[model samples]
Target: MKTYNKLLLLFIFLLFCEGLQAQSKPSWIWYPGDFEVWLGNKMQSRRTERGTFLPPFWKFDSHYVLIDFHKDFDLQEAEEAELYVEGQYNVKIDGKAIFGYPNRLSIPAGKHKVSLKVFSQDKVPAIFVKGKKVVSDSTWLVTYEDKEWIDQSGKASDQSGTTWLKAAQWNFDNAATPPSAYALPTVPQSPVKTEKLGKSLLVDFGRETFGFIRLHGLKGRGEVAIYYGESPEEALSIDHGETLDRLDVQFDQKKDTLTTLTKAFRYVNVQLAPGMTVDSVSMLYEYAPVKDRGSFHCSDEEINKIYDVAKYTFHLNTREFFIDGIKRDRWIWSGDAYQSFLMNYYLLYDSPTVTRTLLALRGKDPVTSHTNTIMDYTFYWFMGIQDYYLYTGDRSFVEQFYPRMKTLMDYCLSRTNKNGMLEGLAGDWVFIDWAEGLSKQGELSFEQLLFARSLETMATSAALINHQEDAVTYGEMAKKLKSAIMAKYWNKEKQALVHSSIDGKQTDNVTRYSNMFGIFFGYFNADQQQGVKKNVLLNDKVQKITTPYMRFYELEALCALGEQSYVLKEMKAYWGGMLKEGATSFWEEYDPSKKGAEHLSMYGRPFGKSLCHAWGASPLYLLGKYYLGIKPLSPAYETWEVVPELGGLKWMEGKVPTPAGEIELYCSTKEIRVKSPVGKGTLRFKSKSLPKVKGGGGLLNKGNGNYEITIIKGKDCVVKYN
Candidate 1:
């Protein structure tokens, strides 16, 4: 009995010791610092940022394992190499199967050793070749040569034990380091008092230090100089600019304070000569030393909160509009470009990453000095600026970029023909299978309509700033171009516009994009509009426009036409498809059938997946403008138009910060309410049917017979019925 008891106790102790060893063993903890997560055992992470992992190989919900190989051996010299883990995972050499585990091994939380062995092709004991054996070198060679790899598993771990491999670093810290400097003070506490003194606009900092000065809408040519002192005579000039360059000057830290000035005249003053007019100005200065210069730290919780609110607002608007839910992979290129235009004035505002990315994508290669293809970059720039202006209401941005904008616009105008039409290469002149089948023969589709719409926007922008001559020129050009388009492309017999001109002759009979352009460019006549509605919107031939490419443009056209029901139905179908396909973020395209087809593609290539956050960011802005009906006239935010068309939505309310102030607009089943810092405008007794707006006051009535209200005080009459 004593012997049996002693044996039992020994067995129990052994089992307990094994369990503890298993628990304490260092299993591979995924390094959050790694940017790219390898999809397969052979894959590796590429780019790292903020400890978020991203994989080089683009795939949806791909599982990755961070394996500590424990040994690194030269691949060239080894007779045979095999990777081994405790679990029953398949092993491959150069993607070729060499060995398979007899029993499936499930990895638990603890340290585990994995091994890799390499062998020469001739089956002889290979010698170590430094550069040749390196995996990175092999990968580069394979990529450059466009060679393929065969999976080799079932190979022995050590055919010839040449040398022991060294262990790799597995545990890495990924905590974010805080900024070394203090946060800059938000402007100065001292009240900035403004007084119009003669031909100069004098600003008194009043015992406060100033760091940056921002001015908006200083028209024509003039020089603005900053000065210090109680009287203009005693003021000393700090910075001076020739020509009207809307003020956006950042002062040096040494001269930021009033007391730091050696002379009494060291004051900040801006002079707008007799011919110039100033819109608005903001003086930013620091009260004390700042903690950080460039880095602005926000917690993940805070960032996520902002993202959630923006996402919710965007989803809500998208749901209301019923835009197609076809999860497009790289479709954000178009959407981001458009949003860039809408928010152009806000490029210097919040969200530096977003703006930087947009700008980076705009011009030609940042690395090389080469001009980009005009339409591609120009369209993107146009959209970026539009979005920037709409969101921030920063007129100074407009002034700074206006010259660049004009330069791009002039380039476009120069490309126009005698017939008042613009022509350019389509699809970068590269023929793809899908695109080829659509047009049959490659031709520039009436896609120039998007360009025309941009022109109209440019014209409207010019008109808003009281550039009457420029407005008239753009409007006339638009009118003539519309007429020429009708004469050149419209087919009265077929009741649809030709898709594009082949060899300068209209040949393709398809009506997909041509009609879309017609709606987009505001070129459709009364009879043609009804025909378009019947043939395109209600047509059953195309099997529901479930592709993101056409869906974006189609939705925009629908909004322009005020066709709520069709827009809502399409939006539901499209968005529903994406949500069902397990999308955490918006996709490039949607496959409704759930076939094994690739979900994300770039121009129909496997490597073309771009998880564009900017593209996904656009739906929110569009929904706000189209569904909620909050439109801004200029960056100043002083003038706005409230025209709500809720479509099939239950209720919607949102706020967009403009230059004039924050514009809050909301709509319910009963009424539509619009509130701004200037005043309030209400449209009462709303129903399923569109509201009838009567009154000339700052609003213009659309062809769909809906009222559009604009609030411009003093200079323009309260109401002018159009």
Candidate 2:
């Protein structure tokens, strides 16, 4: 009887071990390249393309120009004579031609080579001319030659040292003839009109020029087009057309040139015809680029180009067969938006960068020269550094910035009041501008809740690194603060968490932000979770729930509740909703009907708001680490824990590169597999349906160069291999 009992126990232990080995595969493979592009590709068929110059044009500092025409003539003739240029295969003047003049010449906007041929009845004389544009009564020309012309070597030359020439000298004896000079018809200037279109700012003007558009306190990317019309309404209607092929001017950074293209005009025409009165002409644009400093310089068209390249790389490498061919650096850029997107790509491909500029940024001044606060900038820096450390396991970086990180974390901790809560103005608050529940003053509860949650993340990160003492102190403080928050804000009778408390009594109002914080911070008990799930997820009063802009936080809260299936549903809906709504990237908010609405910002203009690459990227990383279950376990940085949570996903597979080594996991309907370097460690399998493992010795000894585990069952496994 005793022998039979022991054998039965051994069989039970073996079955448990097998169950623990059943790992779920990851839905997406994270690599060092841009993952957002991959996400975009999976949902869309076409990738965004890069900027390509049509020819005879030079790109410079986000602008393009033709350098040859102005270099050979003098001020008087160049200003008086009209130039007719075409981007064919070569250049011709007055039906006569010049050899070696590039037809489709592509050059950066700075100084470049211009080969000109002058043909006349007799030998033509060499001429030099000044380039100028006449605007109304004023002649707007390059006066300071030093600043106007950047030489081939990118050096500035003084205009005083240069000379101009006449059109007669260039071969035109009848310089005043009809074809010798070109004139642009003047369009009357009308009053400027401003309108709010969906979540965008539409600025209409009466005329167009090569002038600068200054955004006083704005940071975003959008299409800026010059449109013509007789009245404001007609102009707005024409500008808002879905299929209008309006002129687009793009600044090419690589060649330092500006390239402008129009549908069928020698130059972009903005004139009001005989039958038409000057109604309104303005630049209609959209702000959807990833939000970050320095990233604001690029226009929407330019950003779309970069986004396209990124998406292409992501789609090409999503399959397991192509994993080894991934190029990690193809998407790396110094720009904030590019860098943030690169970090997400790095998770899929285990690659590291030698540069630590992002790390230094976190420790330096957080204040932006613009209206954005220190916290707004610092949050991105911290997130970047944390992601770097999490993937690379580079202690050198952690050691270098640990003190500064602690300083920032300590400062956040210090902000807690006697009630263990802190309140501050929410930076980048435009994402929730449509919420009618917000008071004019501010949402105190939402502000405090975000701070508290940020602190908790910091504390938890510290604890993950084996800073037991520091973690304990921070964790304890977090718990205490959470307790105080519940006691002060939660209403047992109402079955809802109040928005805020003034002196003691709770306010009865419930907000999406407040409730999201409660679930996100784990302030709710099991019963409270049920109430929130019912009220927020299933209740008709909360029918709209929150806008797509807040989908990141919403999904995060759902994940916190271990509701993977529910979160997956929301992810699909949010992603599909944005794509169908004509989003080039994830938007700040969602509109189901495609209304020409603008996202509201506290600073007034929607362009002043951060759009694409803001805090939205946090969800991609979180989904990769938590829901996908490819998380690191040691601060020493050598090994990672392969715990798979299938989360309703079909067959999934991906690789996570860590400082220690690379670990690959794959799962299918029939079987699950985990591969890593040989090391001895215990594996824990977690599931409510699975029974606990009894005394059967947990560690697996390493023998071969590699370790492999296979199981055939459900998708829940925790392997603590060294």
Candidate 3:
């Protein structure tokens, strides 16, 4: 039955691809990771602080200035192909160079090799080739250094050193829009209301947003100052803010102009100079082109509202690459992006975006400082890739990037001390959370836990790629590390994994970081699980997690431990706390103790906190995976399960994306509905009585009032568990 299903799905997919191919044309392609790297630079370089150009302080890498792209094609008949190149490029056919910069070329019948050598310093070297049958796509191979040496006799040297990768391409099908001309889609948006406060027009856009401010009908020769804010207070404050723009307007006619950089703000304070006048302000709302593939709607209004705002927050942060936030430090942070990747699995399920973001974060590997200069963040990068593979079942992605993974893992392994533990060396940021007075000293238990998980990821990836010895090595290393962590960090009195060990001795400090992770990572046994939950997770004395970054794992651990009902209240109190504060989007951190504009402060500055941070969207994952309870048991959803938990909701329904299709589920007190387009699934639930399918068979009883039923693809199942 599975074989037949696979074959049928393949047939349907082929038909769909045929339809798409008929409409679409060839797109530009480049060296596999170069495009993403270049694009990351472009996006990150656009970040401005107080209208001054601000770039990343870390070592930012660049794309290859030179690249060679080539593809061999066999045509039964002669054909003409049009070519578009981004930089100073030379086209070649059959290894012989063609004339200067030809837009069109003729290919003779039979097998032939078409190639282009391009040099671009400012942008990625890319090309778009289109024809009736021959076109540019992933089948083409690209290399950064094409060291092909030919002697006088026209004999070439061994091309061993020249590494060729499958070319990467996105939705750049048009001839006019090459890869270098890529930009996010934008839509014009007007302010909800505007008030003239003396010289400045205080414009309210109603909610948190990211866009380029446009000045309409401008005829001035003075500067226009645009102050942005997530709240009205931030925009109103002129000198004290995170992002603001001052534009010099020299327009003579009644024309319109837009601010050069896109900023995050709902409120814009347009302060014009004395001579600058006669215009209203609007914005071009810039955003990614991702479509919503998964959804969640629950019985609770606040939960629904929280879910909506989380979704919007994630959408705002999902640009060229998943960024930390939009307003400040609009750069990719691995830890922030890891959460975004998980959220994306439930919301967008955009596999390309996942791969693109991963590539960008990985960058060009020379094993620089830990990802984002934070130790835990580097581990998150590996875990992110592993999760991507599990969610999408795209082994080729793992297989392609395993070398980089190995190199990164090697860098990590080399840093371990004599006791097989990691302590923050000079220049390495421990960065467990944003909590105050958190210890960066000593061999941290949280880092060890993440390192063990990262090793496990390496083991899994290595095994997938059939590297048996390396897999065993990584597996053993992970096993040993877990043991080491347990020996060093576990405290019987504390009844939890202590926060860190000070010089080989466990500290009395009991934090939720390692303990919460231990529960979900399956590192803790049953008794230990109960101990940690009681002593640390629920204990009032334990330091609380204020950042949404740590709250994500905290909540996930609770959900995994079957405490969703309790977690529901926590979610309401935490996320719902932000919603009640008139938040249009989720925030970087939310402390109930902080009142009014106090919520806007962080990092020693007002508005230093990002209002729509990517990590703030954990509910998307929690609701879709935990509440809807649709998750893959095998890679790519070949086998999956639905273990829906209402979590205090009377009824909750949602769609979860799988590799092949979606799992649609509706769960309530009396009835349950499930329909899936891919994979075989087991629907598990509990009731006081026996349950029967609407069509026929009774559910299988697993004792203790538990019931389950097998769910096959393309079958709409309705169960009455009365």
Candidate 4:
């Protein structure tokens, strides 16, 4: 009787724990990479120009139509697991088929193999199995094509061609919320003010935002039109507005209707038909749910405001993936996302979003064209992978996606000209920036620099995955290309890399693109770095980078070269120029020379410029990396450093995120405080006299009044220096 009572109590406790876990964590699993592809398609299709559907011109791919998932488990006792599937599926336990799609399966106490084959054409095939010990998760293996066949005896099978990868799963802990049903969260928002003009209502949401507009108590028999704009002037201009929506409603009684699509706008002009009435207007503000794990705040308020606005701009651009802008495109552009990936490391530190964006950009095999059909953008994709690994230190992602990387690199290799170098081809777009009359005619120095960087990334990634042979090959390729770039483009008279090589001869024109990148990419030697900095980056004679897209790198190059004070002033003058113009969010391009409504114009259209571009938010990176001066010297910050710069600030402080945790700091003229959640950090700073330390051991002098102290994890280090 006592044994029976004890057994009942133990069972109840175990059951309670299982219930707690199931409610807290999702148990769904799918073929790795399929969900991201399907989700990317859904998100990318959301763009619209005025009222017309706008889809990507690139060759977008789709998810696999079918998949097989399986796992083996050893049980100490009989158990029951509840199964939920996203599509039609068949279950087999230990090579025996179950009858009629059983929702619950009872497994005897022993080792057994459980498999499920699912099919779906419109969505990714997914499944969830919840039990105490047999929960479905990444531990399960999956494959899109099993490539197995049965012989006449019905027992013989050949699966030599089959390859199983760990099932992919992200935050889909709920069986009800499968990957297909995923959407950005939304909240209801009321407009700040509305003005009525002749049956037309003009509404202002007070700032740039993206959402579905809701029309309340709608009773109409004709058309209701909405014009969306980033500015009030844009909303009032009916025909020239970038985005609009039209709805036809016929209802005897009041009916509330929400717009089917989201639009990026601050102002809306609603034109209603005669007798059509809406009591009020509201919006459902749609946004991605990413935490601000990283933070920045300092002595300068204007700089702080720029940082805050930059964060908001980046947050707005960071939707399903790192989109180019909220106002237009709303698709993953590799160049834009590369800056976003860096900003994410310093702000959100959301690794899944990083991986998801990378996967979506890569898509499935058969590299039909360069990513987004642009040569530089293709190279950016490979560089993004390198940064991802550097920041996340996730080897599994590289291992799983290495083949795709190889194929993409092979596509680049296959397109090389007779000189074993790539140039502008018929289909390839050599888009370095949105600058006008930028030559893409001959071999551009910028393209070769990006190519060399991509090759170096491939070499590093190959070594990470133990593909040593490929690593050596890519390493040699990178070395050769670097030599060719210097030989073909470097002009000592210009003191910079020439813009292009026309028919194997270097052009005299020099641009900031390659020179700025070389500084940060470490492609230039000590002398070359200084020469380029003077002749190109800081030289007023050079063609200035007008767009924030290129400015992200240009400013980054300056920051990497310890020009934080100059970069800070430039960031203030450029990004601060936008703030002065009442920009609630950063623009795709900002030319301080342009005045008034001219800021709204681009590509020959009155409102052609995107008001919230991802690259425009680069100060989030600049401040954290340059001003804050904390970065990972090794992958995932296993080894890191802090060399804080005052950068003309009286005091400054911020926290930067890492894979293991956050690195926090506070700095001033006389004192500095530092703490990290993960290992072996060297804190280097300049001091006038011998510094004092607490929570840290002895400080070693590195000459010229510079000192170093070892920072241990979970302990705060304080230094008092004169």
Q: By lDDT, is 1 or 2 better?
A: 1
lDDT of 1 by residue, 407-499 (tens): 667766766655555555342322111243555343344545656666665676676566788778877876666666677677776567766
Clashes of each: 85, 59, 0, 1
- Compared with the true structure, model 1 gives a TM-score of 0.46
RMSD of each: 31.9, 23.0, 4.1, 3.6
Ranking 3 against 4 by TM-score, winner: 4
* CA lDDT of every candidate: 0.41, 0.38, 0.88, 0.90
lDDT of 3 at 130: 88
Model 4 lDDT per residue over 424-447, tens place? 887887889989878788888899
Give the total clashing residue pairs for model 1: 85
Model 3: per-residue Cα lDDT over 498-538, one tens digit each: 88888678887778898999998999999999999899888
- Please report, as a residue range, the 10-residue window in candidate 3 with the lowest summed lDDT: 690-699
- Best prediction by lDDT: 4
Ranking by lDDT: 4, 3, 1, 2
- TM-score of every prediction relative to native: 0.46, 0.45, 0.95, 0.95
Better of 1 and 4 by lDDT: 4
